[model samples]
Target: MKEELIAYIKSELIGDDTMEMNSEDDLLTSGLIDSLAIMRFIGHIEATHEIKVAPQDMVIENFINVDAIADYIQRTKNS
Candidate 1:
């Protein structure tokens, strides 16, 4: 799932080299992604995971790191 997330993020959102992603790393502060990328990521997550991301859940602090995104996915799935 981690690999899939990284691949989707890189391929769809960034369209750059996928080899640069680190599973445990944060893509936000690294400048590998930006604010706009967050929206794309959210959309991709919702579509791929078949879960809806509420508007209130769209916060930078909640989606800054890969772990956060994973947590969000878990929450959405469980809910």
Candidate 2:
């Protein structure tokens, strides 16, 4: 699920910018995406993962990196 999610985010929302990203790529700080783009990703994750993303959960720590987003989704699923 993590791999698939990252692939979607990379191919769709991120595109060719992946040339510079590690698993810990900071999308927000690196300016890869703005707030609107972040929201779009949040929506995508919600729909893809079948999890509800709360407004309070939309933070840099959760969404800045692919690993972080994957962790967030996994944790949410367990919770």
Q: Quantify all predictions' global Cα lDDT against the true fold.
A: 0.79, 0.78
Q: In angstroms, how far off is 10's CA in candidate 1?
A: 1.8
Q: Model 2: residues >4 Å from true position, as ranges?
A: 17-20
Candidate 1 per-residue lDDT over residues 1-79, each given as its tens digit: 7778878877877887546876667776788778787887878888889999899987876677777788778878998
The superposed Cα distance between candidate 1 and the true structure at residue 54, in angstroms, equals 1.2
Q: What pairs collide in candidate 2?
A: none
Candidate maximizing TM-score: 2
The TM-scores of all predictions, comma-separated, are 0.79, 0.82
Show model 1 residue runs off by greater than 4 Å. none
Candidate 2, residues 1-79: lDDT per residue as tens digits?
A: 6667667767777686365456677777877776776778788888978999988997778887888988899999999
Local error of candidate 1 at 4, Å? 0.5
